[model samples]
Structure formats: C-alpha cells, structure tokens
Target: MDDLFAPSDVSWTPVSPKLAAVRRVNAAIIFGVLAIVALIALGMSLGWTYGVLGLLVVAGGFAWAWVLIGRNQRSWKYAEREDELLVSHGIMFRQLVVVPYGRMQFVDVAAGPLERAFGIATVELHTATPATDAKIPGLHPDEASRLRDRLSALGQAQAWGL
Candidate 1:
C-alpha cells in the first residue's frame, strides 16, 4: 500500500551544517584507522595471491563507510511541536521516530571534546527506550541548553495538562 512507503506525517528540519562537519571529521578518523588495518592485511597477504582480494575488500569497506557518512549527513532531520518531537534519518533504510512530550523523562545537553572544539553541542532526549532515543547534534552549546530547557519545561507542562 502507498501508506507503507509514504513518508510519515511529520515535519522535518535539517541539522546545522556544523553537525555535518563534525560527522565528517569522525568519518575521516574511522576511515584512517580502516586504511591502516587494510594496509597491514595487504602486507601479510603479499605473495600469497590474496593481497588483491584483501585490498578490494578494504576498498569496499571504505566506500561503504563513506556512503554511510554521506547519507547520515544528508538524511538527519528533527522537529518539535507542543505534542511531540521527531527525529528521522538513515539512507538505506529510512527511520522516523516520534516521542510525545508527555512521555519524555529528561533532556540533556552534552558536548564531547570534538564537539566542543567545533563549538557544537548535542541534545539528547531520554525516554523509556535507550535504543530508540533522540539526539540533535551540532547545535551551539547555548542553543542546545536552551532547547533542552524548553523541551523539559514543555514536557512538564504537558504532564500537568497545562
């Protein structure tokens, strides 16, 4: 049915460009590690006729990770309304998750060493499921805190039926 494939009835907003930059940095670091491992494997496989296959496998891994990073940078979206907050992302398999304000347990604004270097913060929404959580990254630290405060307040108000 069309409904099965159609996008959900949810508004979406793109993450800040700064977020993409941060993700790219992370991807580069991961790719560098993979390259090193691949080189080591290639050296070990030399003269065994498996070097070519190893190289190909490593190249494919790099390509796959690169594509995944690109998709993550492109597909991430966030939206919040009085009733709920939504985060949607993924390239190969799209995902859209909605969290009602009334169901939110807490909100946290966090900045890791890398994000701090880029003047960015991540807002995490704590709900019942740790797996199906919400994270909005690449916000200015102040902005992240403000959003956290607003969302927490909204959730509290909603709980009280205000």
Candidate 2:
C-alpha cells in the first residue's frame, strides 16, 4: 500500500515531525471547542443524558480524526528531479504533482501562525498558470528557505522556454 505513493524508484523527503504535533494539537483544539458547544446545547435543550452522550461521541470522533490527520501528514513527501519537482501525498487517494522548472515563474516560502508556532514552513511554486502550481508543506524553516533558493536558481537556469 505504501508503494502506491512512495516507490523505491525515487527518493522521498518526509515532512517534519513537528507537523504531526501541530496537526494533532490543532484538531484537538477545534474539536474541543465544538464539543463544549454541543454539550451546552444538548444539555439545555434535552437533558444531561444527551449531553453526556454527545460529549462522548465527540471525544471518540476527535480521537479518530486526530489519528487520520497524523497519518495524512506523515504521508506527504517531496522530491526534486533534474528538470522538475515531484510532490506526492495521500494514503488512499494518491496525488502526484510534477512542476517543471521551465514553467516556474517564481517560488515562495511562507509560514503561518500555526506553522510558525511549530517552526515549520511551506514552499509554494508558481508556474505560468495557477493550475500547474505545486506546494510543499510541513518543512523545517531552514529547509523551506533552502528549497526556495534552490528552486529559484534551477528555475532561472532552466528557463529556456521562458
């Protein structure tokens, strides 16, 4: 099953471990807030029984969702080829994106509040068209900057069609 997205034919660079923690914490926080709201609503409208049951269901669902989020985050990977960059993700429904250097107009690396809290960043590649753009997320801050620089250099060096 792993071979479907990550084959031995090419190297795969895994996302940072901090990404899993960030994802887990984010999921927990979101579900925690929703669970609180549900408990209040159900308890007031129906009774304590419905509130308790709803809380338990929300907790269980949060656990399951956290597990799935971790799995999905771990499944993400990116690789750089001579002429293009390869990004692959997903456990069941796999997606592979190839961004050619010749098509790349610019490269950018950014980090949001959540990602900054975890010391991770994302690198986005902008091609001639938005449809062909590719993004690699959950990379270490330094790694993301290095990738941005490398891709920019490669894009310039390979800009024969541009």
Candidate 3:
C-alpha cells in the first residue's frame, strides 16, 4: 500500500529535528497551562463545588491546545524541486502551496531566537501577492542562505521572462 502512493523518482527529505522540538515546545506550553487548570479543578472537586467549574476550564484549555499543537504539526511539509518550491502546511486544514520560479519575487532568510538556539533558519519566498507567503522552515543557516541566493537568481531570470 505504501508503494502505491510513493513517488518513484522524487526524493523526500524530512523536516529538521529542531523543527520537531519547536513543535513540541508549542505543545508543552499549551499542556502546561492545562495542567495548572487541572490542578485547580482537583482542588475544587475536593469540597469546593465551585472548583468543579474549573474542570470545564481545564478541559477547554486542553481541547484548544490539542487542536493548536496537533493540527499544526500534522499539516506541515515541504519540498524543493528543480524549478519550483512546494510548501504544504496548515492547522486544522491542509494546504499545498506551489511557487513557480517565474512568480517568485524574492527570497528571505530569517532566524529567530528559538531557531538560532537550534542553529536553524527559515527561507521565505515572496510573490506578487503579499498575502501568499511561502516559507521553508528549519533549514541550517548555510543551506537557507544558499537556497535564498539560488531562488533569488531564478526569480530575477523569470521576471525577465527568461
């Protein structure tokens, strides 16, 4: 069954390990808040009936966090082709965004504190539509820069209709 859906010629690269950690960090923050609420609920269930209401609060928090963390991690994936960039990601929804070499306007390499700690960077590709920003996250800093350069050159050539 796995062979039926696999691409015969395409090479699949997994997301960076640091990206997994980043996703986990997001989950931890949410779960941590829910843990606090759950504790409060336990306190109330003992004798303070008012604390029973805290269960709903904790449950709601858990649900919300579950949705956020679970959904985001599930829908994130990407691939770089010879002439185009493919990004697939979303939370609670799946999106496959393709940016052709010709439509790419610019590529940016950015790093934040968390990414820096992981020694990873993000490569963002901007197109004519400001709202449609495509990004490849969790790249090594050097790889991100090289991709940026290559994408930039291809975008320029494409802009000239070459």
Candidate 4:
C-alpha cells in the first residue's frame, strides 16, 4: 500500500519542520480554550471534581493531537516530475495527487497571519477540474514563491506545447 502511493525513484521534498510547531501551537490554543470552558461550565453545573476531570480529558486529547500533528506533518511531501507534480500525505487514509503541468490553470502562494508569523506559506495549484487541484502547505516563503513561478512557467510551456 505504501509502495502504491510513494514511488521509490522519486526524490521527495519535505515541508518545513516548523509546520509541526505551528500546528502544535494551534492545537494548544484550541485545547486550552476548551479546557478553560470545560472547567468553568462543568464546575458550575456539577462540581469542582467533575470540572477537573473534564480538563484532564481535554488535556489528554491535546496530547494525542500533538503526537498526530507531528506524524501528519512528517508525512507531507511533494515531488516535481518532468511532466507532473506529485503531492502525498496522511498517515491512515493516505492520498496521492498527480497534477499535470499542462492541466494547471494557475498557481497561488498564500500565507495567513499565523503562517506568516511562522514564516511559512502554502502553494496551491488550480486546474480546470476542481477535484484535480492540490495545495502543499508549510513551505518556506522563498520556496513557495519559487515553486509558484516555476509551476506557472512550466504550465505555460506545456500549454504552448513548447
């Protein structure tokens, strides 16, 4: 099954490790809010004991997600081929997307507030078919820009049959 998604000959490029850190921070913020809410709500409705228990459960969930975020981030990789680009990720339900240069209508590089704070960007490829479009996240800004330009040039060249 792994062999089916990942080719042995291709040299895969991994996203920045900062992705895991950013994800962990995001998870922490979410879980922290949940914990506070749970503690307050449960404590008021039930008892302080139940509130602490709820907070514990939320903490456990965050711990599990923290591990998963690292694994998931490590799994993300993209490889550029002669004619197409391959992006693959996911630990359990893996997905591999192949986007042909000729099929790409546009490429986008974007960085949200958090992503910009972390100095990372996402590169999205748009095709005529929405289902064929794909995005790679956690790339450095420079790499994202270079990829966007390169992909645009490649797509144009392929479209022109040059």
Give the winner by lDDT.
Answer: 4
TM-score of 1: 0.76
- Stretches off by above 4 angstroms in model 1 are 1-11, 44-60, 129-132
Candidate 2 local lDDT, 50-115, one digit each (tens): 988899999999989988988998878998888889899888788888889888999989888999
In model 4, which residue pairs have backbone atoms overlapping below 3 Å?
A: none
lDDT of each: 0.75, 0.88, 0.71, 0.96
> lDDT tens digits, residues 14-75, model 1?
77677777877887787677766666777686643565566567667767776667667777
Candidate 3 structure quality by residue, lDDT tens digits, 31-98: 66766766676675665454555656666765766556555654556666777776776643556677
Per-prediction tally of clashes: 0, 0, 0, 0
> Which predicted model would earn the best TM-score?
4
* Candidate 3, pairs of clashing residues: none
Evaluate residue 99 in candidate 1 and report its C-alpha lDDT on the 0 to 100 scale: 79
Q: Sorted on lDDT, highest at the top, how do the candidates line up?
A: 4, 2, 1, 3
77-101 per-residue lDDT for model 4 (tens digits): 9999999999999999899999999
